[model samples]
Target: MSSRQRLFTLMYRVGFAPWDGHPLPQALRDLVEGSAALPAGTALDLGCGTGDSSIYLAKHGWTVTGVDFVAKPLDRARAKAATARVVVEFERADVTRLSTEAVGSNFDLIVDSGCLHGMSAEDRDAYVREVAAVAAPQARLLIVAFIPGSSFGVPGIEPDEVKQRFARDWTLLSSGDETAMNHNGKNPARQYLFQRAV
Candidate 1:
């Protein structure tokens, strides 16, 4: 396994996953709740540790697939989804090397919370291409990532990088600071919403 994968596996084994169990981001919630909520559709949760967001989407009538690189989390996620009585397909796979044949495709919605920011530049490029390949035309994408230099000892991504990377395949819809995320409340985060270009 890659060092990053090993690190996450160890974290999950020790129950030190701070990224898990948090409430879904407001931007994500808006996609499924309230009057402005979107119609139920196929969704993909990248780096879906423990399947909270995947279960949320499934509970709202979506067909959800949750992917994580570590096997430990996939086991936990499957158990959680069973207890929640929501049918979410949990898979052990690297987001950077995702394949349509493995996870299926044409997802109408995609969510990445605390995932993309942790990847190397080459992995991020591969991730963008892999995601775009599976997204339906005009698919809505919500990404929550720590702002650059604010991820404590971990890597973070700048909003400019987010836009620049997705410029060709996605249209930037909106973005804002989400201060409640990250290891400490002091480090600022961001949520970017995009639509897949037709």
Candidate 2:
């Protein structure tokens, strides 16, 4: 396994996942709820640790599938879904190696909260291809990631990079600042919205 994969595995094993279990990001909530909500449809949550976002989508009337590389988080996610009285398919799979057989296809919406920013550049390229392979025409995608060279002091992605990478297959819909994530006060983040080109 890759070092990053091993780190994630170890984090989950020790219950040190600081990214799991929080209110859904406003950008995601706005897309699926309230006046401008998109219609209920098949949705995929990439790197769906503990499934909070996936459960939120399910409760909002979308058929949801949550994918995670770690096994322990998937267990918690399934239990959380059960407790919430929602059915969400939780799959243990790598986002860069997604396939129709691994997690189905033609998802109307795909969410990647704090996942893409952590990957190496090569993995990000694979991520873009894999996401498009499963997205339906005009499918909406929401990505919440730390902004590159921001106050977070961690490696992050830039908006231009996101747009440039998916330019051929997806169109930029919106890009805006996201609130601080975890205990990193004033951490600058950005949420990018895109739609698969028809």
lDDT tens per residue, model 1, 105-142: 89999999889999899899999999998899989989
The collision pairs in model 2 are: none
Task: Return the clash pairs for model 1, or none.
Answer: none
Taken over the whole model, the C-alpha lDDT of each candidate is 0.88, 0.88
Task: Compose the digit string of candidate 2's lDDT tens values, residues 1-198.
Answer: 887789899988887776665557888988987588899999999999999999999998999999988889899999999999999999988999887447988999999988998889999989999999999999999999887776332478988898899899999999877653534556467888999998
- Model 2 scores a C-alpha lDDT of 0.88
RMSD of each: 1.9, 2.1
**Model 1 regions lying over 4 Å from their true place:** 179-187
Q: After the best TM-score superposition of candidate 2, give how far the Cα of residue 95 lies from its true spot, in angstroms.
A: 0.4
Error of 2 at 170 (Å): 0.5
